[model samples]
Target: MNRIRVLVVDDSAVARMALSRILASSGRIEVVGAARDGAEAIKMARELRPDVITLDVEMPGMDGLKALETLAAGPWKVIMISSYTTRGAEITVKALEAGAADYLAKPSNISEIDRVSSALIEKIEAVAASTAPLRRKKRPIPPLPKACSALLIGASTGGPRAIITLFGRIKSPLPWPTAIAMHMLPGFTAPFAKHLAEKTGLPVIEVTERVIAEPGFIYVAPGGKDMLISSSGRNVHLRPDEPKATYNPSVDRLLETGAEVWGQGVIALILTGMGQDGLAGARAVRGRGGTVLVQDEESSVVWGMPRAVVSEGLAHGIMSPEEMADFLEKIRSMA
Candidate 1:
């Protein structure tokens, strides 16, 4: 098998060296070159034509965000290397929504470099292997029940962009509360929710504590915690209780609790992600006569989560982000 070609970009020489060494340690990856800044990275990307680029989120003279605009238009996949700071988190979220495939929080010290290296290598492989979502012909959405108490969404990987696109198309207010469980690290969800509010023109709140779930508001699960809804469907609880799941803000836990609370009034949508976190949750929703929709493979960054639901006959329909917005609008009109 051909090793995945990679270009490492960072203004700091130390960062570039560390990243290159990490990638070189992986048998499946080849560090083709390293660039000092965004301008240099862009020039090198054109010349090297690597399969993936690890871009530093902040650099002197043309940062990752600016470089991403050009890199996103290229054939190569881009991953943002971000600092574990509020500013870094905000910029990283923008990069993800803008077109970057994924992001990694830079390690604070040498002790954490090895830990970050494993995750970095894994993300690079996943991003390199991911195919662009195919655009499938729109299908007729089957009739759904008239009453939906909550709209629960689960996503990871390519979720930020997909979620933004879906919400952009939704102009009207939804009759029920919308809760989102996106796989993100702590210190990132707040900025993500802020970005969602800015882009969608909706009330977006990151759940940090128990609160009443209300209509017309988009609730985002806080990163590193699980969000659960009460059986009464009125209260939202944030807990850091689940330790077994690989991803935090557990999608399965959110969907399962949603089903328990809303029962037949639940409408769950599974978007682009890398794993089957939402499969069991979708099952719970379907078993309770609720509707489960998945983003079609042609529109997903990674098709694992949605595919798992579809393969098990759990999805009521498969639709693109725009189609999902239309479906939600139709439901709101009925309500």
Candidate 2:
């Protein structure tokens, strides 16, 4: 089998070398070339026609944002290499919005690059495996369930864009409280909630401890913590994620507990993400006879979580974000 061809682009020779080494270590990836700036990257990308490009966020001539726009005409996948600082986060977000496929945070400590090598390899492999962009199936929208009293969602990886796509396409505020858990950097969820509010004109909230949840409001799980449903189902409480848990806002815990509280009155959604975080939780929802809709692989940035639920026969249906809005609207109409 042919390996995944990659182009490493970073201004710092040391960074380029470091990233190249990591990619080289992966048997599935082949480093075709390294570029010092975005212009050079564009040139190399055209000539070499690599499968993936690891582009730096801050380059001297034509930053990753601009390069991404120019390269958007091509089908090659671009994974941005960004710093861990605040400005870096902003640019990384912009890069993603600018058409980049994904991003990797540059740790302040160079030695730590080795720690994320496995993840780097995994992402490269995942991106390369799906050579084409996901294709959304134009399926007939299913009938509505009239009794859903709550909505819960979980996403990661390409989550910000997915959430925005979903909420923006939704035409109106929901009649039930909606909660979301997106694995994100600490301090990013506030801005995410703000973005949602600005785009959707809904009451998007960042969770605080012991907040009473009401209909027509949207609650976002705070970064670096877990938000779980209270036993009453009408209230929410925030607490630290389980000590051994890898997902800060554990989707499994949230979905399972919400299942216990709402049972058949709940609707759970698993969106674009890179792992099986929602499967265990979704099982609980499915067992309780709740509706579980998933973002189909063709519409997802990463199809991991939703794929798991669908593969396990836990999802009621899989569709694009815009279609989810129609589904919810149908639910509302029945109400």
Candidate 3:
């Protein structure tokens, strides 16, 4: 059987060794090469042609972002290793924007290294399996659906950078807050929210058990749970998810709740991911007069989520990230 080939890139010799050891520990993965800096990584990448690359955020001569820009345009899937700090998280987001598939936060200390080792292995394996090329390239302005009061986005796998890139294309703050349910594990959503706020220049918060939804902020569903929005006395409220649900932070559940409370006021964007989590929710949204749009397959790293909606004829529009932005701007123009 063919093994997953990996190239580990980092400035530190110890980190390179540690990461290589971890990858090698997994029998399914083969560490094909290691590079001390970004430049060397580029050279070695072209030579070794590994299936996946583990890139370190902080390098001496050349950094992960620079290398990512060059590699993202190429065929290889890259996962960034980032420090577990605010600054590190910000840099990691930049790497994703430049085309990273996923990220593993660097443990803060030696005692935490073992924890990160397991996570690193898991992410490496999962990311390596994704063979689809990223599709959303142009900065087409997204069209805003008419009379829409709130936006809901669902994604997994290649979702973070896609979300950041989509929001970055929007020139100004949105008229309404957006609720997002991106698949994630625990302990990552807080930093993810902070990074999204910094990237989009809009306020973002992780969803709690219950809170009133308001305009001018982005409400992100916390990892390992679901988000349900309702209306109470003219105020939109957030509530806990159903017990023993299938998908954590279930996209279908969130959209269904929005349809229940907001009816035609909700607009849904199903981005790249595996599975049909958002399709039924789109149905719910549309059944109640809401609008639903999905990312085009060519622009999506994996078109599963958006494809499901498209297959069912549930999406009002299917567009690329750039097109979505342009479409939204035009909708605002007509309004």
lDDT top scorer: 1
TM-score of every prediction relative to native: 0.97, 0.91, 0.78
Off by over 4 Å in 1: 133-135
Cα misplacement distance, residue 167 of candidate 2 (Å): 1.0
| Colliding pairs, model 1 | 133-298, 134-298
Q: Write the per-residue lDDT of candidate 3 for residues 243-334, one digit (tens) a residue.
A: 67667888898898888877887888999877789988999999999889898777676678898999998988878766666666665566
Per-prediction tally of clashes: 2, 0, 16
Worst 10 residues of 2 by lDDT: 128-137
RMSD of each: 1.3, 2.2, 4.2
Model 2 off-target regions past 4 Å? 134-136
- Candidate 2, residues 1-335: lDDT per residue as tens digits? 89999999988888889999999987878999999999999999999999989988888878888888898678787888877676777677666656677777777776689987887787777766653765556776655666888999998877777777778877788889999988876656776687779867988998967899899899999878998999988798888766688888988888998999999988998998888999999999989989898988886777889899989998888888888887888788888
CA lDDT of each prediction against the hidden true structure: 0.90, 0.84, 0.79
Model 1 over residues 247-328: C-alpha lDDT tens digits?
A: 7888898899999888999999999988899999999999888999999888787788999999999999999998989888
TM-score ranking from best to worst?
1, 2, 3
